[model samples]
Target: MQAMTYHGPKRVRVENKPEPRIEHPNDVILRVTRAAICGSDIHLYEGLIPDTRVGHTFGHEFTGVVEELGPSVQTLKRGDRVVVPFNISCGTCYFCKRGLTANCENTNPNADLACGVYGYSHTTGGYDGGQAEYVRVPFADVGPMKIPDDMDDEDVLFLSDILPTAYQGAEMGEIVDGDTVVVYGAGPVGILTARCAWLMGAGRVIMVDHVDYRLAFARRYAQVETINYRQVDDIVLHIKKMTDGRGADVCIDAVGCDASGSHMHTVLGKILKLEGGAPTAIEWCINTARKGGKISLIGVYGPPWNMIPIGTAMNKGLTLRMNQCNVKRYMPHLLEHIRAGRIDAKGIISHRLSIEEIPYGYEIFTKKQDECIKCVIVPPRAA
Candidate 1:
């Protein structure tokens, strides 16, 4: 099998590797059909995530065909097309029972935070991801959802992560009718978050990013106001002025560690490694939100620390919420939205490449080249 093998930071290539086999009673082997490179994957590719070992594949948003099933998996069988959640969760756990599958205790019990996630890093349980021709899925009964026969793989591939994550990001904002929501970052997740905010009855949505293409795409796709943060002298002040000086009712940070705004944050966090990934977007969210406003963080940040504006948040009595999205909890509801044509989830895909183009996919996405918003990898075998 050919897999995206990691050598080091900014180094990945397609190479022949042993195909995964069922290793647990609840495990199944999937011939990966569609694997999307997430923005967070760039963190791993750039060697930001701790213990992202060389030779490990990095992908989580994928859909595959169940080529083989483990003995204990009774609900699914061979040839079942499924989209597996990135979180490797055990449904019987306390957290899973509460619909918090991302924190499933039974999986990744050794970790202090999130449960086993596919190909994130050793900190997230060291499970290899699906950026290859095939992947092994464990706790099969709990994670993999069967795709509707009428739908194509492209139609629901994001159900594995970003779609539900975007929806969850907006839900955390606790938006009410006529509330003004400002989303920082106009990437795939940010744009999707803006769309979800409107669906939840937000009267207005504003998406911020330096990339003109992405901001324009957000305006067209999510129908939200767009701001090129780079053009403004002060993003916080500009947003404050936009919201009539009171600040937005809700602010969302969708651009995690890679956020490129504050020089102080970038130098301390990304360069000096003093804090965790740069909290530029989080800082903006805290500084620009109205008093008693809600802020939702759906961005991926690394461990250790982030220099956040805690004093400002406390002073303003802002409500903050954040978590890796519990993908299982929202997949069914989102699927309905997709089916009804209320949300064109697949429209976010801007690039599709074969397994051989894995490295290229990562390159264009990281460089934000070719007007790319999202890239999906199709393994040659599946192609």
Candidate 2:
């Protein structure tokens, strides 16, 4: 089997690797049909994620067909089409029972924070992801959502992560009717979050990003206002000016780690390794939000960046909420939305590549070249 293997930072290649097999009673061996590279995967690729050792395949968003099922897997069988959630959970655990599937206690041994996440790192239980021809899925009954007979693989692939994540971001924001919302990062998640805010009754939505193409895409796709933060004198003040000096009713940070606005943040976080990640978009989120407004962080920030503006949020009495999406909890509801023509989950895909072109896929996506908004990888099928 050919799989995308990590060699070092900004380096990956397609190489022959052993195909996966059922390792646990609840496990299933999936033949990946479609897999998407996530913004979170870029963290591992850039050598930012700790313990993302060489040879580990890194992908957490994908859909596949069940090629073989373990003895205890009852919910699925061979030939079943499924989209597995990135987070692995045991459905009966206390956290899983309460709908906090991301924190299920029984899965990850390395950390108590998140349940086992596919292909993230050894830090999240060292599970291989679905970026190859075949991958293993553990606790299969709890996480895999079946695709309907009428739908194609592309139509529901994002239910694995970003769609639910963007939806959860909007839900966390508590956007009321006529509330003004600001979303930072015009990447797929940010654009999707802007769309979800409208469904949640936000009267206006504005998106911020440095990229000209993505900002243009967001404006057209989400029917929202756009701001190229690079052109603005001050991002916070500009957003405040737009919101009549009160700031937006809700602000969302969808760009994590690599935000481009702060020199100090980039120098200390990305260069000096002083902070876990640059807190630029989050700083903008805190500063651009109205007094007593809500801030939702759907972005991936791995470690503690001591410079986060806790004082400003505290002083303004803001409501801040953030978490990894509990994908299982929202999958069914969001699937219904997709079915009802309320959301176009597959519309975000901008590029598709074969398993052999995985490296090129990474290059264009990481470099933000070719107006690439999102990438979907179609792993090769063996004869």
Candidate 3:
């Protein structure tokens, strides 16, 4: 089997690796059909994620067909189409019972303090990922969502991660009817976040990014207003101007890390007076929220940074909610939405390449070249 392996910053290779097998009694093996690149995977490729080691798989957002199941896996059988949740969880854990599936205790026994995640790093559970021809899914009953036989691969693939992450962002913002929502970053996840906000009944969805292509994509798909942070003098003030000086009712910082993309600069602007380097987008989110408004941080954070304004957020009486998406919890509901055709999650996919092209795909996606939003690495069967 050929898998994309991450060695270091901007270093990736497609090499032959051993096929996966069910290691745990609760595990199942999937013959991967479609896998999509995620923003987090880019972090790994660019060496942004701290403690990420070499020789790990590079993707987590994927859907596949079950090839084999462990002895205890009775809910699903061979040939079942499934979408694997990015977050690994045991449905029977205490946290799972409380609807906090991301914090499942039993599945991440090696995690000293946090829940484990697939293909992230040792700090995130040290588990293998699904960026290859095959992947072993532990805790299969809890992590795999059976895809409807009638649905197309593109429509269901995103339900694994981006769709859930987008939903989590909207939920974090407390989006509601008649509310104005502003989302930073028009990348795939950001666009999906904006789309989810509109679907959740937001009156006006404003997206912030400098990419004309992404902003245009959002407008076409979800009717979101566009704000290019590059052109604006003061992002917060500009947003306030658009919102009649009240700021956005909900502000989502979809731009992760202190390092910015080609369109934006740092994660935090120089205007923020924090001690170390703070994320510029986080700073913008803090300043862009109306008094008592909700702010959602859906972007990935790497290592520790300084220079964030806690005082401003505290003074404004703002509500902040952020975390890794509890993918297991939302997969069922999102599946229904997919079945109903309410969300077109596949609109973000800009490239589709074969497993052999995995290395080149990573290069373009990590460089943000060719207007690459999301690249789907299709297995041989998909061709």
Clashes of each: 0, 0, 9
Q: Number of the top candidate by lDDT?
A: 1
* Model 2 residue pairs with clashes: none
Worst 10 residues of 2 by lDDT: 299-308
lDDT of each: 0.91, 0.89, 0.81
lDDT by residue for model 2 over 28-100, one digit each (tens)?
A: 9999999999998988888666788889998899898899988999899899999999989999989999999
Ranking by TM-score: 1, 2, 3
Task: Report the lDDT tens digits of candidate 3 across residue range 170-234.
Answer: 99888879999998888888888887888889999899888787788888877888988889897
Across 16-53, the per-residue lDDT of candidate 1 in tens digits comes to: 89999889999999999999999989989887677788
Weakest 10 consecutive residues, lDDT, candidate 1? 261-270
lDDT of 1 at 337: 95
Supply candidate 3's per-residue lDDT for 184.
Answer: 89
Q: Flag the better candidate by lDDT, 2 or 3.
A: 2
Instruction: Evaluate model 1: give its TM-score.
Output: 0.98
